[model samples]
Target chain A: MTAPIRKLRVATTSLAGCFGCHMSFLDIDERILKLVELVEFDRSPITDIKQCGPCDLGLIEGGVCNAENVHVLREFRKQCKILVALGACAVNGGLPAQRNRLDLRDILEEVYVTEDGLARGSKIPNDPELPLLLDKVRPIHEVVRIDYFLPGCPPPADAIWKFLTDLIAGRTPVLGHGLLHYD
Target chain B: MKTSNSEVSAQANARGARAKAARPAEANNVFTIDGREIPFEPGQTVMQAALTAGVFVPHLCYHPEFRPHGSCKLCTMKVNGRPTTSCTLPAAPGMEVENNTTEINDKRRLLIQMLLVEGNHFCPSCEKSGNCKLQALGYALGVMSPHFTLFYPVRPVDASHPEMLLDFNRCILCELCIRASAEVDKKNVFALSGRGLKKHLIVNAESGRLADTDFAPTDKAAEVCPVGVILRKRRGFAVPIGKRTYDLKPINEQADRFKPLTPLPKEEF
Candidate 1:
């Protein structure tokens, strides 16, 4: 018998996205068993590993919207040989980047201070626990060199499977017709 | 159209008169796009002929009913080894055109990317996500990402209209609305002003609000927007995402403009 194939270590994380992409990734359903045979998980929510040890593939969802996101993305990029921006958020800033047009302070003020339902003397949060928000919500590629971009609201599970299979087989991933939808 | 190619040459080859005489009358008015013979009328451009032939040459701002604006360069194709806009370039017999090639589509992707980043195209949030032509073209042409730094150009939202909304953030500057308003509606209610970087659409009224003008929801201009700019108020997400135009069929296949009309017939030439 031939030698058993080595499982590729794949890592995934979300930055500013709604976690819809992560949900879509799980939409692979029973394919998870097949995927496990091809790739092992590292630092992904699926594995619950807090830190990423040198990984073969890193699939990151969402845009870089804060200081913590930048650190996580850069660290993840350093560990992975190939990094894929997972969805519309990570690829082109997505819905979170809609706030890019407004001044950050004004938005904060509108939300925390002048809003109707706020409690008396409510103000912007300055908790040391919270990650500092970036002035503009930006695509992750702005902070790190991305190897591949898979774009969609939450790229359909079928598209994700196709991309992952292509990568697993050591071929260039191609999201074909009806696969690269934004919504 | 090149000014040098006069009417006589346009109808029948001025330089290839002998070759033209050898062919049948119906066969004389034909050109090849991607090496496939595509016939054309005297005044028809490569775009019209290709559309008439049921061939899809990806385009924006070249509506069948209106004059070819050629403003949006999405339909740029190689005409005789030179880059030329197909929408305005008058079709001439035997002129080779290269369209739907990897090279052309790649350039078109870059063009689409530029259009995406130049404005704030947050497709997920935009009301026109699935229905928008720009977004559809992005999908159809395989634009993996915006690929450029987002300009996030600040533009006004004209919610002044009771029945409509003008979200300038998504405008690709195709000016189809302007043409539709002026030519078909007979109401020059919209006009584009300013220069590059500053270029934007303006309402014709002194108040500069869409409601100040008599633009109705039924007007052609109201329906001509290829993007999310001109929208009907309170109609957001009405069609659902996956069922909208370009969602049901890829824009290239839906372009049905190619469903064959025998190149305008020889007599119309």
Candidate 2:
């Protein structure tokens, strides 16, 4: 007969988020079994891989707040055919962008200098190992062309499930009002 | 009195004629909103008619009780191939209005984006996250993000009142508060100042504080804000998440079909 159906390669990552989106992904619960049957994980948190490979879909779960985040997002955009911004953070910079009002230097001073419980000479970290922070937190789409957006703090597990199933079925995944929540 | 069948029929007809004459006559001028024919009364605006007919024309500043402000042009619709704000436009018979169109929605989305960028809409941390009309309209229109650059304008929060707090940072310059205070509460405590992008809400007190004015916690102005600008102190998030009005259902579903057209709860949190 014809060639057997191939499992779609999927990858996921967190940038400047609290990893709540990944936790929501896990909240998919028993449906994960069905998800695994239809798709193969590649360079995801579950796989612990260092880099993303050629994949059919990529779930980006945070806004870009650093040089490393930009690099990783561009890589995902390059490797994946469809990129989905997975939470409020990835969609609109969420709560992290609140700091956009304050000066970056002022923010650093508030955290590293004004705050107590550090070495007497505690200053802003400048280690080469650490990723450099951006002037402001920006949503993922501002940095790359995002194909879809799931808008929630961490989009409800069922919403994520519906998105995945709808995409797999070759239908345009339009989020309804019941499924879309900004909070 | 003994009556024949013919006489009884005549009496019944006369009584029916009297009852019909006693009733108040309503002039119904029907208009079409997105191809659906909606019957409107003589004095109703297009927005009022559409809302009465269970059709949503996403609005912000146009509250039903107050005169149509027409400040926020989010309800812009094609009335007979000409664009007009439905809130201010009077409904007329045989008028064709296109509301739910791609062109108008795109413009509406841009207006929303402009509003978002102009204000500090921190929905996750703001008290009006679920209950805010502006936020609900954003969701209803499928605005996943504020697609413009963030302005991050510095605005002050007036917490002078013991019972009320005015977070000016979230004000969209809707003037709902101004209308409520002047027309309903009769306090004349609130007003708008400046113009263009600099337009802002102001209190009538010399000290520029709400406590110095005659505004009380029970004033109609206190409950009229569609956004998080006017809020009661210490009552933030009184209703838990997922149980709020807009949280459970979208803004369109919550719109009612009859009088007392204020869909958002008045005193109830």
Candidate 3:
């Protein structure tokens, strides 16, 4: 008898976020063990891998508010079969969406320039590797085509696990009860 | 804990009697804001009715979902010539109200401007630049610079959550997030940690980082932040400026136009 299709390749990354999305994943507690058995995390901070390769799923956990985030998201879209905008920031730009209200020049000057800023020793390194901050924060789908959206500030862990299990089982994921629905 | 037949009947009759008595009182009463005449049904607020009537009043703390805290003095409107929070003020018929005036505008502007300087509101670098309610109101009132020096305290970045960023530098102490956490989401994740101008947002029960707290990324408190203080991780700068919320219309106008159970179009997604 043929072995069951036990594992799927998955990659996850954060862009311009506080890493709460990943923490939410951890908050799933014991459910993560079941998740790990079903999916192989190829490139993730938890795994400490640098670049993304081909994967069945790409879980992006932040808003694209900088040049680096845009670059990484583009790569994930190119590599992954399905791209999930996994949180409020990834979907509606979350609280960072408020930054879409401000001008980019003002942001740079406030952090880098001004007497109180530089005089108080706010350092802006001249490192070429650092990604430049964008003028505004934007949701991921606006930059690239997203297959699905799991919108919460950070989606609950059970919701994330349920969505993945549904997708793997070739079934459409149903929304959870009440306000917990990942809309 | 089994209920007897007589007890159940008595409870049912009592509930029926209460419902009947409540219906007439609810029908007879009309909601009003700051004493202005308004047709109000059940489950409506004074602020909701006033905004529906095209009366522009100042407010910072009263969001639609949370109970009115009456903490911010910005929404203060004169009811029977007495200053009161229109958001919390109950609707009563034959109540005279006054909102539009140079005096009120001046006070509102000063209060907002003070909030700007109270924090390190480096407007130039602020993520909530053009789209900020605080900034828009400041522009409307011709507040060019913070007339006073900024407090310029280097606040901590609660970078614990992987999906969101909490920068205390941009907070104006509006308490929208706090109310959203406490009342709407039923999660008391945020609280005012300090006093007066030195006040800052603290996470968890103690003065711990947000990562240490039980703050879920999906909490309304995270979503309700008015400034760039609480930022989502990966979704910023994904959409171009032309497509963002600020580019459409001022938030105040938008809020007024679509107040109290206005259905948003699906395309708004």
For model 2, residues B1-269, the per-residue Cα lDDT tens digits are: 00010111323433443444343322446766665677887667888888888887788987777778888999898786788998888788767677776677778878998998788887777888888988888877777677676776778789889999999989999888998999888889998899888888899999999889989989999888999999998889799877877878787666572232544223211
lDDT of candidate 3 over B1-269, digit per residue (tens): 00010111323433443444444334555433323335654344556667766655556666655566678677776665577777776666444455544555567767876786566554434455555566555534433234343344567677878677888877878788887888778878888877866677788555477776777878898777766787778766676433546445444455464255543111110
The number of clashing residue pairs in each candidate reads 3, 0, 40
**Model 3 TM-score on a 0 to 1 scale:** 0.49
Q: What DockQ results do all the predictions give, each relative to the true complex?
A: 0.37, 0.32, 0.01
DockQ for candidate 3, please give it.
0.01
Q: With candidate 3 superimposed using the best TM-score fit, by how many Å does residue A95's alpha carbon deviate from the native?
A: 22
Model 1, A1-183: lDDT tens digits are 121278788899999998899999999999888888778899988878999899999999999999999999999999999999999889888888888878999999999999999999999999999999999999988788998889888899999998888778776777766677787
Docking tier of model 1: it is: acceptable
Best by lDDT: 1
What range of 10 consecutive residues in model 3 chain B has the weakest lDDT sum?
B1-10
Superposed on the true interface residues, model 1 gives a C-alpha RMSD in angstroms of 10.0
**Ten residues in sequence with the least summed lDDT for candidate 2 chain A:** A1-10
Tens-place lDDT per residue, model 3, A62-126, is 87988999999999999899988776667546566456556667766677876372566665556
lDDT of 1: 0.82
| Alpha carbon lDDT at B191, candidate 2 | 87
